[model samples]
Target: MTDALLVLNAGSSSVKFALYEAAQPGEPPLLAGQIERIGDDPRLATGGTSEPFGQSTDGHAALIGGLLAAIGDLAPGDVRIVGAGHRVVHGGARFDAPVPIGDAVIAELEALTPLAPQHQPHNLAGIAAVAAAYPDIPQVAAFDTAFHRSQSEIAERYALPRGYAEQGMIAYGFHGLSYASIAPRLPALLGPEARRVVVAHLGHGCSMAALLDGRSVATTMGFTALEGLPMGTRSGSIDPGLVLHLLSERGMDVDAVHRLLYDESGLLGLSGISGDMRDLLASDAPEARFAVDYFVDRCARAVGSLAVSLGGLDALVFTGGIGENAGEIREAVGARHAWLAIPPPLAIATDEEGVIAEATARLV
Candidate 1:
């Protein structure tokens, strides 16, 4: 039987999976799929076929079990899953590389939950579920925060007190696996001009990074994913005083404010219609137009700011869902920086699963 690697990217509402030949590094996945909407109206899509799940796949474990069963049915009988790689959102200050899953590593990741409450727990749940099902299989965690570890200390620091900075309240950029996936392909795409590049990873959770010679020198995200550009349902970087005002003057508690910024803000709040960029782009409503305009403005501003960090812009690479699909967004953001005279922004599809699979294969 041919050995295979299973890669899992578990989000709050969905788990995306892919299987690759363990002996093949750059080959395409043997099978890829996602189980979306975990708690509400679940659906499974694989090999271009989409269908509602017949079984009750309520939690991460059940959903993953169902996914495994589906893969077993679809995969060639000669294929054997030898290892699993996971996309973990936060690696905290301790981990800067892919690591083998162990009790100690799991506990350390659990301590980082408060740093990324929306993602860390769900990621851990996926790891737990995989362990329960494939007790002997080796699993490796490839972190989204690990790529930014190459960034300098000054770029990662906050202006807060020394004590706070020492306490891990510094900027720890996210969307790293995406950036990691794109960095290697740059030299081929841009050649010598790839020295100073700013990659905008615009999706439901948006962020940008300044890469100097393929290394992350600066990024938009901070200690949390909420610190970057305004995203689908996230407010991005809002005034800290506004949060305090909600807590005190508006009579809202921390939990209420959290829900507001994390779930009720961004494009959805701005348009009062939908958080999906596809929806906003299609709508003729003034609010929708304004939200789109705002998103583009901030994106351009981020490029300019990141350009400053790179000393100048050699290339601006766009990836992630919105960046890859939205032509109007790319055009508008590019037009704002037309003065730079750089070539058009390059759109590269990210392969976090492939990166995870490679890491898992190497470590295992």
Candidate 2:
């Protein structure tokens, strides 16, 4: 019998999970899978196991049920779920690293909803589902904003006043779990003092972080998730004045502005078709090319600025969906940073699921 550690990463429309044979810290997972479009007919895919689980419209609870059913199919007695880990997007300044979830922790996460309304609700939903599914198993919270919590106050703080800053209005760099997964490896990828590293995590969402000795010295995202690089449908780094103009001049309310920034911009807004990179790349529409070019240009600029922040760049690491799969985006970002001498740009497939399994195993 092997102890299995289950990990759930719930996004806006889907939930992904990995079931690994629980081992010591830093070990890899045994099997992994994900279910996209959970509420509607979900798309289920597995890593080690090849047979695809077909359409089911049971939502997150069904997804969990499907996973449990799948595990049962593979010698239920051998696969013991020791613990579960979840990826929560924003922790504000409350969590500096991964922590065990509790009633107080749930309260703390609930309080930060205003900081990450798009993700926090779904994150809590997945967490709540897990709590209900496996009430006895110990669950852990792995904050995407946690690793960057090591960033200096000056780096995280905005130029705004103190009251809002006290109310958690600051830059809490995201993709911390992904960043942390590749951090220690940077030294091996570069050198022991690999002091200056700029990592761009481009996926459904995107952000750039300037790391000095594995700790976040600066990052592109600020105060909210919408402040960084343009993503699948997110409008990044828009002027604050535009927000006011939208509210006052364009008859847009707070919720309307939020949707525009969080759901209707980026590639979808530019291409006027799809938010997915693959779809845009495959399309013949001029808007598709325009959207792709715009994404690359902005990301290149962010890397240059982040590289400047680190004095110079030692290594440029790419992770996440776009970074790992889209060779074109990486090449574009790489071409921009070619001035850096020796050790050509490196792109590593980030293992957030693996990282979660490892972290959860240690605490369990």
Candidate 3:
């Protein structure tokens, strides 16, 4: 049997998976697909084939199990998954690079769920599911925050007391894997001018990172993924006083506030339609237009801030779903910062799964 590497990126309502030949480098996946709408009308698609997943259960375990089973039935008989890699959203201060996942590592990662409540649980769920499915296979975790470990003290710290920084309340940026994948490709695409780069990752969860010589100097996200640009459902950066008012004056509990900020806010709350940029772009509604406009405005503002963090801008890269495909949004953001005189923003398709697979391959 031929050895293969499996990479899983499990989200709140979906699980994306890819299988790559273990020895293959700089090649596309042998198979790739995703299981979407886990709790409601789950469906699986691979290689242009779509079908009902037929699983009664929901959540990470069920979705992952269904995906594995489907791959078993669909993949070539010679392809044997030898190892796995998982995209963990938060690594805190403990992990700076992809590490082999053991029981102790799992425990430490579980403790970090509070920092990335929306993503870390699902990420760990993927790791657990894969371990259960393939008992003997080695698994590695590639963190989304690992690449941002290069940020300077000032960039990582908040204005709060020094004690908070010691307690790990400092900024831990997300989308590091995406940024890492993009950073190396920048110089080849943009020449030496890629030295001072600002990469905007604008998908369901959006953030920007400033890279100096392919290393993170700063990022828009702070202690949590919610502390960045307005995302599909997240409220990005909000005022602490507003949260306090909700708790004291509006009778909102912690859970309610969390739900509002992480699930009901951002594009969804702004438009009162849908959080998807595709839907907003397709709609003629004025509210949808307003939400898109707001997102572009905020992204442009973030570019200006990141430019300052880098001292200047050489090239601005646009990745992720909205960044790569939403021409109007990129055009608007670019126009807003025409004074920067940076090269035209380059829209590069992010290869997060590929990055995860490569990280896992190194261990195997």
- For 184-211, candidate 1 gives per-residue lDDT tens digits of 9999999975699999999878999999
Models 1 onward score TM values of: 0.95, 0.92, 0.96
lDDT of 3 by residue, 1-364 (tens): 8788999987656778898999983489888888866665688878888788856466777678767766777676668899999999999998999999999999999999988988898898888888878999999999999999998999999999999899999999999989989988988899985699999999888999999999999999989889979998899998899999999999999999999999899999999998889999999999999999999989999999999999999988899878999998888999998898887888999898999999999887
Q: Any idea what lDDT model 2 has?
A: 0.81
Cα RMSD, each candidate: 1.8, 2.4, 1.6
lDDT of 2 by residue, 67-106 (tens): 6656556433567777989889988887876788889999
Better of 2 and 3 by lDDT: 3
Error of 2 at 109 (Å): 0.9
Worst 10 residues of 2 by lDDT: 48-57
